[model samples]
Target: MNQEQLEGKWNQVKGQFKQKYGNLTDDDVTYSEGRFDEMLGKVQEKVGKGKEELKEEISNW
Candidate 1:
C-alpha cells in the first residue's frame, strides 16, 4: 500500500497490529503526520518485521 492508502486506513490497521502484536505501544502504532515511514520503522524494530512485509500485512487486513 502507498502512503495515502496506509494513512487513510491507519486506525484500522493500527488495531490489527495491536491484536497481532500486544507488545507494541500506542507510540509504536501511532501515525505521525508526514512521518509514516519513521513510525513504521519503530514498529518494525519492535516486531522484527520489515516495512514491506508490514505494509503487505496491513493491506491484507
Candidate 2:
C-alpha cells in the first residue's frame, strides 16, 4: 500500500509489526507524523527484510 493508506491503517499494522518484532516498543513502531519511510526503515531493520518481505509478513498477520 501507499504511504497514505499505510498511515491510515497504522493502528492495525502496529499489531502485525509487534508480532514480528516483539522487542519494538510502541515508540519504535510509531513514526512521527508522515514519517512512513522512517517507520518502514525501522521495521526493515528489525526484521532484516525489505519492503516486499515486510508487506508479505504483514499481509499474513
For each candidate, the alpha-carbon lDDT, in order, equals 0.78, 0.71
Candidate 1 on 1-61: residue-level lDDT in tens? 7767776787777778889989887877653433877887899999999888899886887
**What TM-score goes with each of the models?**
0.43, 0.38
lDDT of 1: 0.78
Model 2 residue runs over 4 Å out of place are 1-8, 32-34, 37-61
Clashing pairs in 1: none
For residues 1-61, could you state the per-residue lDDT of candidate 2 as single tens digits? Answer: 6546655676777877789989878877655433866777899989789976676566567
- The ten-residue window of minimal lDDT in model 2 covers 29-38
